[model samples]
Target: MVFSKKRSFTMLAALLMVSLLLSACSGSKTDSSTAAETDKASDSKTLTIMAETSSHADAFKSIIPDFEEKYGVKVNVVEMPYDQYQQHLKLKFISDQAEFDLAYVPIGWVPEFQLADYITPIATEQAKLDELELDDFPGIDNAYFGADKQLYFLPYMNETHGILYRTDLFEDAAEKKAFQDKYGYELQPPQTMQQYKDIAEFFTRPDENLYGVTLMGENSILSGFGFYNRLFNYGGDLYDSNYKQQFNNEAGLNALNDFKELFQYASPAAKQYGWSDASSEFLQGRSAMAEMATTVAQMAQDPNQSTIVGKVGFTAIPANDANTSDIKRFYLPYGFVMTKNSDNQEAAFQWLEFATSQEMMEKAAPVGNIPARTSALTGKLASEYSFYKPHADIMNSFRLETLPLIPEGSTITGEILPNAVVKYMFGERSAEDALKEAATEFDELMKSRGY
Candidate 1:
């Protein structure tokens, strides 16, 4: 479906303008444009960055020693788990107790941060952005702009969701012949839901101690990412155009039902699996397939952590054969944003400049990073890695857009929606009821905020 970028960008400010800031942690933001840097980055001896513990963070982080020697500054990094990252950053910023100079922001949090005025508008850094060739990164975040059309962060890495499976198993002569005889179809990467299910079931051999898939069923925003991949595949969104909650309908039900089916083929312990857990299952060669954020799945390429490095194969998420829908693949942008209340804005910008430079992006690429740079994606790495072309195709797709942007976005995905999804997966509720509960609660929140 054509998710209207223009439409969403226009709605960004209007949707978030009325969000009530936390009164307990009230603080003022610096006026970066006209004011002098609170501490000149050049004079600052130390810089602190808050990052989530992920490949994205490690890409730039592993090379920080080079930055320190070049700039002569100490860089201290605080890493948080994905589940805790949001709340921790929010409390830190809203309470006026933030010590972070810059943090790599996920796309979902940009609107909330902008609406709450927790970050500085970095329009003044246009020169640095130009030097870094900002256009080299995916432009999805540009369509999520606020009323001022200002950028609040620097883009570093972008990724989308796609399927990863074992090529070794799929290509095995004996296994393929057996799969063909039993399933009556070629045993290759899944292109249809029925094929996906059959292959998942085929690979599920309990005696071999291997399951079919690594289904991440964690009860957090990770579930949102997991569920929304299915939701988007079925042409479902969190809300309809009228600001009405419509996900309790057919598309939503179908997406949620996917989990119940996938559950049968994944590890019984997958009931509690997060992305990290799910990837581990696949990396250790214990599971056959996993739909992963493109960059996260790059872990399969690491010889240190992965037993199935060369065996891994990548593909787009398969669709239900009945629904001839053009899906928007799950995509997100991660980048560094300077906190308005930070004491080290100047140094943070310097770090951003260094991290996103073309040279640095290329450097990060070889170090197990899916760098968000045009050159990196289109360069020799595209031929070196099996997934780079697919990743680039999703980014360059005209249909590419972001997930819904609203002030209550975090609550909808992180809490309400995922909770209901988990309940449905555990058979605590029917698909309809679970989605209804989530959609209703989301509507109430938006209404209370005057959306």
Candidate 2:
């Protein structure tokens, strides 16, 4: 699933504060109903879950039957579009509606959920942790819960960007010779940002209705993610160690300029592209390359949806001049968050454990769900999946460290900074000016939140 903007921290904090005040003056009317539901859950054999209708849902469907047979519980899963899932969940939570027992949460949403008390710590039922094989998920517990050291969600999938390119184009003898003659290097997957640009420009054939690369030019969270991935790879940080804004540096400028250059080589509709648009561009053989999540590897190879089925290749995103690593990738782990007010915490946790178990993840691996569990990621399952090795290697070696893990961190990364990228993309502001605007907003947010 693609990245989507989280609720703004300023708004979330204000809403939560109001919720607290309201509950203080008049007790929660749902409390008694919630207790009743808890008792009902213990006797009933049904549970509800809300999740994104992506590959994850596909895999969930396959394994859900087994879980249901084992627990004798019927689970009704409500699948929603990725863009709507966050806001939908927020509405349900704020309204004190226990419409679902568990939710598939993006890691970036954990802090917001925590602030609203929408999710309970996984530690509440520590005994279940052992049975789920907690140690199997290396770096996951830390990656998702390191900020407050409270495990609020069970890791389901870890997503990171990778280059999906047309192998047939790279291997064409005539094109290869021409590329080498013109660029002085073998035509292959790019290892550096400059090489990436050169290749994009080289393959650009606009008259033929084809272009070089697919640009995530939409002024939304995907655009933000697209920009920050490059910004970080270019040695830029959203903020310094002390949490002050620092994206107005040379690295940010270079990254932005490089990103802008790709638009010239991108499709005419590049300005409207998001993650799905980019994926479609590569799958339909419209562009030479696309930067997308590793999860797309399966989709790119599927004969039904892709014309480039056997011609696609996967690799890490290119590195900037200052960065030593050939591929520096940022990862966001998706997990299952059990609502704090769930009447059936026990049953919900059981479902949570079942969903994230190594066994279930192994089953999902073939269908494009990248496992967060070290055992699952490195086990025979990954080896059997043709596209998993390179992604696994990138995950192990080149994980990009992102912004500080403060409560407002997701808001900055997912919203404020992204809005700046949108501004620059639309010619409303220069790169430096846009980042400066974001920096000012970031500082004010952090200060207001008592950072």
Candidate 3:
């Protein structure tokens, strides 16, 4: 009886083991199917976007809820400070660890990103291109192309440097007449550097409440670009086709001297000023005029930030010379790019298309950014925004010239020239001495990079 019972127990154990195996197989199949469904749901659509901290981004986020409701996908927006965003992005792309799927890049930085193989070309979607009206975008769609002609980015915001003036201060007919009498022209916003200088000088009353022009005089890429914009307008180029430093010439010296001459009338703190300081002083009614980015139009009109709301006027950057033929114009374009490390290329492209689309422009234009799309500018969207109309008019009137689209353009403008220009501006060195010294340093830097 004991042997029979032990044999039955052994058989019972074997039967239980077989039943467990069958259950395990069924569970494995169910798990596999659940995982496949989860992956399919995840693959439906999602985009992670990195954007700069601009009023534009705020407007974008405000409308994202609507975007999600219309489209089936969700968008995650990551806003970053302007200064640190580029470095953060570079780190993300280099490590192939970017959490974000798309980024808003300064149009000039496209080359650097492309050189690192971080960004994918927009032309990757030929079918999407056929559906989108790319020609509606202003400036150059090809601005993001590499030397080999690969489209790596798309312009999200088309910006230009323009004059932002206090209309309340200049509205007096007598003051306007006096300005015209002194300068031999109407007291309109200047079209030439000489006229700009005259207006700056005319408006300056250091002992009174107001001063003359203020600019971004701090040593940074923006400052360097500002100086070069003037220099280029004055017929100076940083490099020839051979990539040699040619800014040590007379045109450069003249540009430097022109910049220096403004110190007599500019605010005493101009040396410490960047875009923020300049914008603040101008908005606070501390300065008569300022050369500023087009985005300042919103700030100038905002009742919250500006004391001179609805009393601000806009105009193009002053030409270098009196002759229209000799005038040189340059504007920097800012845009969006997709990183190569992004796993969701299609999603990223869709987000880029949407952000740069007419719909987004309608939301963004009211916030004071110059929309990249011509349709957005000409459409009811721009007309509804009282402040953007003048800026749009100015942008449309010009062909929009820009510096050469090269990889080293940012470094040259930001690192090399800004320091040299500041040193000259502060009387630390003469313009010639500063330019000569800077040229030597820049040449060495380029050589080290094997440029």
Candidate 4:
């Protein structure tokens, strides 16, 4: 069924806002009232930006003065908590007097927004697109494009899930010797799901207050993503071309069972862990490895925040046997959407181009926004960090077809499928039963939506 966009956005936003800093704008000398005094009075426009109160929001605020000064415009940034950001925007879009010109959109919400005519194509202006260096943002543009093949959003944060492990733990003399004696292979970052499991099992030592992996086992977004990362590698898909559920098949069963096995090697609180707890486990040196968003790479190396300094390593998630060539992983893109109902589309597009440019991306990286551009990954600062290049590589190699592109995508990803994972993980149902129930629920949902 069509998910209540208001409610679904609230839930998804809450989960994502945890790592964000809820701060207001710190720069910008130009206020909305002074728009006409800055430059050509007739060309000046007051643009209001509605974005989630996050690190990216903070970065956007920091750069406002630059844009306002250069373009002779005023930007009023209205930051909302994650839970209210989407609902607030939706309400504004449907109103007779919609106030926002630009919005920070999560990729999963793109289809619903486009279908409701809440957002307009960012690429409709070809000259603007070329000037923004849109081609530099590899593996992200298509995710924001509408069904008509028009780009509707610009990439802000480009994230992919991967293995973050302790380099020291993997290279330890004693641990390496023991691992080789048992598994008959060099102890290193995993290259296959089977090897990943074996390493997790080998490293587990609850008595020493250490766990092999830090799994996001909560019933929210992260856990669901964990399942998808494995599900894709194992050749399981959420739905087939006909929009029929396919996750109840053999590949699905194997993926779910393998995911369950991981919990046994994870932290004791893994069932309650979301993205933060999982990453914190690795940062605190309580977990030897973690499968999480690449955004945490810089955080995991900050000496003030992490104990694992100079010791973290990253790699793409391993593939299952049959699909070695089709490595599937999550690509959660955060981007900017220009509202179709706005009065100042041109000004908003200018702000969007500046906010998502290579310069802004590089500046935003230290604050938590993963760079969506290819140049940022190979740039000086990114090159200094061992983790950035590999993460960039993984993002480039992601299977574009893995995530569901339907209008009900958010509901399925952020709610329905995740509920089934909780049931199966808690042993309340078998893999077969859990997926079967999920398939039935999805089928009914699609039918009710007139799919």
TM-scores, each model vs. reference:
0.84, 0.84, 0.85, 0.86
lDDT per prediction? Answer: 0.76, 0.75, 0.74, 0.77
* Candidate 2 residue-wise lDDT, 38-102, digit = tens: 64567565677777778876777678788889888767677777777777778878998855678
**Off by more than 4 A, model 3:** 1-44, 322-326, 381-399
Pairs of residues clashing in candidate 1: none
Model 1, range 1-451, lDDT digits (tens) per residue?
A: 6559988876775566544433223323223211223333444667777777777777887789889888876677767677678778888888886766787778778888888888886546567656656666777356335787777867788777777889898899999999999988889988877788899999998789899987878898777777776787677877777778757788889888886788899889988998768888889898888867776568888898899878887876766653434666546777877788776667777787788877777778767678777787888677778888877766655256665667677788788889989999988998888988887798788899887
Deviation of model 1 at 309, angstroms:
1.9
The count of backbone overlaps in candidate 1 is: 0
lDDT preference between candidates 1 and 4, better one:
4
* Candidate 4 accuracy as lDDT: 0.77
TM-score of 1: 0.84
lDDT of 3 by residue, 1-451 (tens): 4568889999899999998887675422223233433544576466667777787767666666766676766776666678867777777777876755677777877877888787888754567875557778766655647667766767767767777887776787998988878877888777778888888999999888688787778898656756776786777878887889879989889878887787777888887888788889888888888878777777777888898887778777766654444454556667777877667777666666676788777776666566777788778865444545666655565445665567777778788889889999888999999999989987997898887
How many clashes would you count in candidate 2?
Answer: 0
Best by lDDT: 4
* Each prediction's RMSD to truth: 13.3, 10.6, 10.6, 9.9
Local accuracy of candidate 4 as per-residue lDDT tens digits, 1-451: 6779898999788866753433223222224323323322344387877777766667667778889898987887767667676676666667844556777867777787888887888766678668888778776546555557888878887767789999999989999999999999999888888899999999899999899999988887677887787788767888877888878888888778888888999987999998677778889999889888676777786787799988999987888653445666667777888888777888988887887788877876776667777787778667667888888777656565425666788778877888888899998988889888988899899999988
